[model samples]
Target: MTAPSKQTVCIVDDDAQVRRFLAEVLASVGLVAEQHASGEDFMRRWQPGKAACVLLDIRMPRISGPEVHDWLRDREPGLPVIFLTGHADVTTAVRAMRLGAFDFIEKPFNVQQLIERVNQAVRLATDKSAAGSGNDGWQRALTRREREVLRGIIDGKRSKLIAAELGISERTVESHRASIMAKAGASNAAQLAAMAAGQPPLD
Candidate 1:
């Protein structure tokens, strides 16, 4: 069993079956799971500083996912939220992204994809907790391309491979890498990687 201190992948959906299925999926990958039936219920039960990330349903009774996200931004900004929507639209997706949701995925989502995203979110939460609040500002400083490069670096790709994957030159990849390091206030690649993973730099 996961200890109480272990991070949980929390699911907030109105449908009981969906919640059960999600919980089971998370368990299949050895991740701890928590579930709530509605947004209001989740908000009422949620405690600040818990080691958890939320998989929020877009449409729910009492409060919507975006509404809950707004509330969380003010209360537990460190908690990462990923939106799950059965009826996805451009406007809703845009709004969710604008509000800083970790990611907005459509329902009937691929199981593997969902698991991967959950794993990434959990890693992010763990990092944020370890790195302290200043890390959030560094993350926000990255541009879209720089963010992609940072992820590539975290995946252990070299500049050459990242360039090929991103369809850019090796020189361009290096430039992006340097920019990411600077924006993250990292003096070396190791420190930048630690920052990207939300870990405090090693002394």
Candidate 2:
């Protein structure tokens, strides 16, 4: 089989050791790593259509990871972002995911798992680029109610909880979930979530 073309994974963190360690790990798996010492440095160098995915540290010296993510959302909506966070930042990381982050990994991460998520993010970015405009078509096809259900799903809410919050029945929530998956051409929640990374922020 032919080898895949190397893709760059941008590592934006204040810690030099973390960046170097992550770069080495990514390199071991045939991926190239681009290191940035801080979020400010990353923002200065970043442009649209660069890097397969970003490994962003949640807490940086300046222009924190969430801030960078917000900037990316406007300019490079299709680019995948995987937050690197500590245990205390898990809540913030989950909020980021709800707001369209590709994924988040806690510090002292598992090397193999991190590699797997990065590869998935890269594939997602490639697919989005190939699809030309990401999930806009299907996202546009969704009704306002469906969008609400999708937001709940992206927020990691269970059907019963979503139903309660939305003042709908559990069955209705499930139906909306099914319709969402169908519209997104996703077979499961994870696939739907991956595609949701490209979806616009729900009102």
Evaluate all candidate structures by whole-model CA lDDT and list the values in order: 0.72, 0.78
Clashes of each: 0, 0
> Each model's TM-score?
0.65, 0.67
- Clashing residue pairs, backbone N/CA/C < 3 A, model 1: none
Tens digits of lDDT, candidate 1, 1-203: 23454468789999999999999999898877888999988888887766467899888877988888888776765466778987645458545553456666687879989988788767666554454456466566556887788888888888889999999987667656654553454545676677667542222
What's the distance in Å from true for residue 6, model 1? 4.3
- Tens-digit lDDT track for model 2 on 4-50? 43288999999999999999999998888999998888888986666
Candidate 1: stretches off by over 4 Å: 1-6, 132-203
Residue pairs clashing in model 2 are none
Displacement of residue 56 (Cα, Å) in model 2 is 0.3
Residue 203 displacement in candidate 1 (angstroms): 17
Q: Which sections of candidate 2 miss by over 4 Å?
A: 1-6, 133-203
Compared with the true structure, model 1 gives a TM-score of 0.65
Number of the top lDDT candidate: 2
